[model samples]
Target: MSDASAVTVAVLDDLRQESEELDLLVAGADAARWAGPTPAEGWTVAHQIAHLHWTDRVALIAVTEPDAFAAEVEKALAHPGTFVDEAAGELVALLPPGELLTRWREGRDRLRAALGAAPPGVKFPWYGPPMSVASMATARLMETWAHGQDVADALGVTRTPTARLRHVARIGVRARGYAYLVRGMQAPEEEFRVELDTPDGGTVAFGPEDAPQRVTGPLLDFCLLVTQRAHRDDLAVRAVGPDADRWLDIAQAFAGPAGPGRAPKRGAAGRGDAE
Candidate 1:
């Protein structure tokens, strides 16, 4: 049995730290800042945070009522197109600032324990198939890194992806096929290598060495852009060759509709690779 405890622990800690960081980033910003629009359509900083909180609420239900819980998510998404905005507003206001922070911390702690104790074979109906607790924890970490990008951008704060976020990047790289299929593209042939810049300016390379396609850049930037949190235009990531470039274009870090992704824009300056 793959014990997911290690990752569960890491994920929980990352969430706690970033949540605390977000509190710091948004603390001085005005309410308008919190309510500021993010790249996510119909989502603001508050809405993204609310989405995290709301997800925590639903994810808690995963251990037992996974199916029903996911269905509720579907129902929520299925609401009339315009309702997304209205629903986001309602959810964003669901918690008072302090209470939300408290719950966010407490809930993630509980989440660690839950994931650590989860049976490897327990299946989540909506997510489909039984997942080991490792997969479950990784999934959450993926969510945190992606959404945290939303908060970081709204504040114009450049967030360097931490070493631990590699787990998140790995998840994104592994999702390549799904990304292609999602975009109605033929999953490419030709093996590829992902050469990513670590949060500390080191490199972690994945895939076969001989692979012609290589993705190289700050790991955090790649993850953020891939997951649709930070715009590709906002980060310094390079896709060598045509196949690699294509992946960057339609990379969908989350499991939803193909989002609006564009070419690299004039990204603001940030800490360069320490190396």
Candidate 2:
């Protein structure tokens, strides 16, 4: 297969796998469990699923209706800071757990179909810059895994880390500059190396081999840090050099605001945050 085709296949596989794992996790939960609080402050399991569904719809619009998607982006920009959060809350409040799950599943299926049909090398507009179909698919996978973590934590369930995290880790490393740019800081000129130990007893490395700045850690810890799912103090990632240190503090693989990530849970025990 060509490189682009390979990327599309890998991203789709990861997306489907992540969704299936999350589906099994919430399959038997009652309504009360869906209403349980997640690590994201004030966001319940229902909210997590709603957010994913809403984004899936937005992505579908991006791929299929460029003008409409542009208009929606303009609307979001007009309201500025509060629109996304407000819209997400409204969505979750309107849907019951079963309905929310159905909506998410349907939207994701549509999104996958749309992505598959997209012409090769075509770019889809997003809340940020436009992304190629492969990058768009990978972004969806990253979001799915991150939100799934929230749902898993809300239910106090342990998730088996998978090799799919390699995609998230790669995104995290590539977004090094974007993270600094969003914070209005000048991204460092020096190249930084990221070394991660994956769950399958393999290592994934990014950036130049002899770069001065480096981040080294378990894949789970690196993924958690970049996704803003856990506090830096709660993760085991180690950074060398000033740029690497600052990047770890503000690492964001996803677009939008620098989130007020989860607070360090000093005494919380047996949770997945630290691992």
Candidate 3:
């Protein structure tokens, strides 16, 4: 395995740990709370967890049996994006909240082990292309952290980013290309110099010494803002250079076209406007 591959594994480890943290945070909530509104629009935290567990199952299936991916996506797409809009409300309405959490915990653990033990060199077919197991793992982390933040926010809790968030930061950096393309601009070929503050009150920086594009902030802040899991005003990321500034304004870690992008103003009202 190469360095890049190791990064994915590290991200997987982060997901595993974060999954446990999320489980603890959401434990023992009432059905109504489960049904309570989350920042993720229609879906509640329960729905988000279900989706994460679902992806683990689907991704593993794609790895173990590559031939079935296309057909599976057809079935998977039946639920729409993350299936929260489809099943979470129903799950919250029908099942006991405890049961739902129990199911999600079991599913999350199973998927964790499955990915860890996934057959080597497997490239799970995704919307983009067949991604190596490592990429799949990173995707899992990104999803877990992004969605978990939703739950944390709903509960008025602050979830800090671990050192492992370097992976998420990296994805946000690379996805600048996608952001640019979505806006009908040629993808910038220049690399980004990313800097994130760590959980231990330290800063993490990446890329070349003189990289023109740079992202600097706390890892949690950067991860949350870039994933669109949270608004930019919540974080204090400083981006320099014209291209870097625009990309940061719209950097999306997920696979998709750019939606409306908001530049973080120094002072805006509300929690989202916090600098």
- Which candidate number would show the highest lDDT if scored against the true structure? 2
Q: What is the C-alpha RMSD of each candidate to the true structure, in Å?
A: 4.6, 3.1, 3.9
TM-score of 2: 0.94
RMSD of 2: 3.1
Each prediction's whole-model lDDT (CA): 0.67, 0.85, 0.69
lDDT of 3 by residue, 107-162 (tens): 76776676777766666777544677677777777777787887888777886657
For model 1, residues 39-119, the per-residue Cα lDDT tens digits are 676688777766666566666677656756766667656773444456557766776555555666677667667766666
Misplaced by over 4 Å in model 2 are 267-275
After superposition, the stretches of candidate 3 with alpha carbons farther than 4 Å from their true spots are 1-9, 75-84, 87-95, 182-184, 257-275
In angstroms, the error of model 2 at 248 is 0.5
True-vs-predicted CA distance for residue 40, candidate 1, Å: 3.4
The CA lDDT at 68 in model 3 is: 79
Sliding window of 10 residues with minimal summed lDDT for model 1: 266-275
Local error of candidate 2 at 162, Å? 0.3
Question: Model 1: how far is 161 from its true place, Å?
Answer: 3.4
Model 1 spans with C-alpha error above 4 angstroms: 1-8, 26-32, 73-77, 80-87, 121-131, 262-264, 267-275
- Model 2 residue 138 lDDT? 84
Best by TM-score: 2
